[model samples]
Target chain A: MKLRVKYSGQLRTATRCGEEDVGWSPDRTLAELIAHLAERHAAGRPHLLSDSGAIRPSLLIAINDAAVMANEANATRLRDGDVVWLLPPIAGG
Target chain B: MEDTGQRSELDAAERNRYEWQLWVPDFGEAGQRRLKEATVLVSRIGGVGGTAALQLAAAGIGKLILAHGGELRLNDLNRQLLMTTDWIGKPRVESARRRLRELNPHVEIETIEANIDEGNAADLIGRADLVVSAAPLFAERLAMNRAAVQLGKPLVDCAMYDLEGRLTTVLPGRTPCLACLYPEPPPHWKREFPVFSAVSSTVGSLAAMEAIKVLAGFGEPLASRLLVFDLRNPCFETLPLRRRPDCPVCGPISRPAP
Candidate 1:
């Protein structure tokens, strides 16, 4: 399965690319996809996961423009061609 | 029918001053009248808040309560439009008040030298019919959100980083509040983030428009939707927002009839 992932705000800066298509195992959870991307993009690893390898609570994950709560992100299963967006909370005035 | 007495009457001078906007189809004299009677609280008069306050005053909002604690620094000029070089050491909110008053003398301007906190958030938000949350910290933004939810007032939140900007409106019980989106402060968020003047003002201008729409009771507001934009890529996307049934801040409040 291939999933399209888009980055916004600081995540875009860290990833050095606005979006990319990542090939992943079918029926894999979103958490696995995030870990794969975090490993591939070394600069975005810190922003994507904490020291304990858990996804950061502040990272907003959305599938097709619908918000997924931080806690539920790990359990969210992905399908082929799903579009995921990762955005970090930005508060600069 | 709206309570004309509470909305107040627009005098000839006021009508003439806002003649162009008054020509809007649904927002004719009625909308202008509502603007003349509404009081808005804007937290932090830096890049986003100051710009939002300026547009609100220009739109003839009856009163503005600005709260920003800090003296102007040389670094603030890049996006803090309300500050002048001469007033570097002076309080920032005063400069915001002065500039806003200069834009529209008819609109009342009030300044508070301190930013919103848990202790004072309720008091500041209670006095205004609507709120604009533009503080740079999640702590302050969440405080204002809690107060707005508790007081049953509308809030427009403006934020930006680098070339990206975001805006959302909270209609208390009817829509998702700030806490619904961010249940807790982001651990990695720092006080200093990259801010381009253009991006900040863009979000601020949209925030002011959202406030005006909510106040005037015309046009569609950004309730339950988050508008995110990236100027570098020149892309704008609206993400659907859902209220968390367990959201501590707004979950218990009963939704009012539309």
Candidate 2:
């Protein structure tokens, strides 16, 4: 399955790209996808996940424009052609 | 929330000064009255809070409680609109108060020489009907959020990073608070981020408008929605938001019936 991944704020700074297309297994939970990206972007790994391998609570993961909260990321399943948006929390006034 | 019940009547000068906005179909005399009665607390009068307070004053808000601590530096001149070059070494909130007063003398402005923190957040938020959380740190924003949620007042959270800005309105029990959105501060998040004046001002102005809508009950507030815009790509998007049931801060507040 092919998915479109979008990045904004610090995530864009880390990933060095606004967006990209990724081919992944069907029906993988959002957490798995985040882990996959963590592996792909080795330098940005720490920014994506915590020491416990949990997607950092501050990183907002949205599947198709609906934000998945920290407690729900593992339960959120993605499929072919889905759009995932990763936004690191920005508090700049 | 109880503040709306006591909307102040607009005087002749106020009505004349706000004549154009009074022409707005649903936001006529009543909306103007509501704005006239509102007292909003804007945290850290920087790029975002300064602009938000300016807009609110121009829109005839009755009072503004400006809270920000620190001396303005040359670097802040790029985006902190309320500050003047001459006031570089002065307090930022006082600058904001002076600028806002110059713009709308009819609107009362109060300046606080401190930033929002867990200790003072509740005390400051306690005095206002609404809040604009524009502090440059997660700790400050979350502090304001906890106070606003506990106080049952509306909060408009605004943020900017480089060319991107985002905003959301929190209606306490009716919507998800900031804690629900970002359970914890981002690992690498820092106080400083790239900012363009235009981007911060844009988000600030929009946040002010959202505050107006929430106060006057005229337009649809960004309740349960996040509006994100990136000037680099020139795109805007609204993403749906949900309340986290386990959100410790707002979890105990029962939602009112529709």
lDDT of 2: 0.89
Residue-wise lDDT of candidate 2 within B22-120, one digit each (tens)? 999899988888888889999988899889999999999988999998899999999999999999898888888888888999999888898889999
- How much is A26 displaced in model 2, in angstroms? 1.1
Q: Encode model 1's per-residue lDDT on A6-84: one tens digit a residue.
A: 9987788889899999887776888888888889998888778888998886687899887887688668998888899
Once fitted onto the true fold, the runs of candidate 1 whose alpha carbons sit more than 4 angstroms away are B1-7, B256-258
DockQ winner among the candidates?
2
lDDT of each: 0.89, 0.89
How many collisions per candidate?
A: 0, 0
lDDT tens string, model 1, B148-210?
A: 999999999999998999999999999988988888787777888988899899999999999
CA error at residue A13 for candidate 2, angstroms: 1.0
DockQ of 1: 0.76
Model 2 TM-score is: 0.96
Q: Relative to the unseen true structure, what is the Cα RMSD of model 1?
A: 1.8
